[model samples]
Target: MAGLKPGAPAPQAITVHGQSRVLEIAFSDGAVFRIPFELMRVYSPSAEVKGHGPGQEVLQTGKREVGLLGLDPVGNYAVQPRFSDGHDSGIFSWDYLYHLGSQQARLWADYERRLAEAGVDRDAPMAAAGGGACGHHH
Candidate 1:
């Protein structure tokens, strides 16, 4: 995966805290993060969320209470989460997870800004999918 960096710290432990809606991950380098499911859903690396290129991103909303239905490993490189809302295409590489964990605050701020610009409530229900590029990969 292009997102995986050389010598990146590998996860030592990964726990899904269903009650709190967070994915707690501990890295080999001793960095631990409790990433929220909502954030992961909103910032999913899948084409469904990121779209095909720049300026094509689909803003995600109403994910504040999103829950993880499952967490499946992707070989030795990443984890694919099955969200309660039926999103499961995102395969988050270790480096990407680390980035999310490390940059949570900045990402949240960005998401908030996007919502504000769209004049949408943070809890506004997402529009039905299939409005743009498909998430299918060849």
Candidate 2:
């Protein structure tokens, strides 16, 4: 998928399927994806999850119980996720979301490696990490 240009219209609809743990995003440009919540959480664009730069990323664990509580639009380019556990800071831009969707496999593998190094289970209870339980931004 090509990168989304700045100022382009954002997605037309974003739906969270609680039972499937998937987020369905439909863009005005006709791209659509049913992204799993685990994929979204593990690939959150927040600095806490993405880190300040490459190699600083913190792996997310215990996010199996997490869910998207709501989606709040941020201006014209991004959406703020109201996570079920009350996390609402990450402003997921259209470009970022698309990138994550395109690079899901690589990102998931990296996240799994980090979790292994941290001795954490991706589906277990949250540990006492600096960030919130699931490691997303506060």
Give the top-scoring candidate (lDDT): 1
Cα lDDT, model 2, residue 52: 72
- 113 Cα displacement, candidate 2 (Å): 2.5
Task: Write the residue-wise lDDT of candidate 1 on 47-123 in tens digits.
Answer: 78888899888989999999999999998889999999999999998988999999999999999999999999999
Q: After superposition, how far is residue 110 of candidate 1 from its true place, in Å?
A: 0.6
Query: Over the stretch 7-114, how does candidate 2's per-residue lDDT look in tens digits?
Result: 664678888899888888887778787778777777777876777778777676777778888888777677788787655668788888877766777877887887
- In model 1, which runs have C-alpha deviations exceeding 4 angstroms? 2-4, 132-138
Q: TM-score, each model? A: 0.92, 0.77
Clashing pairs in 2: none
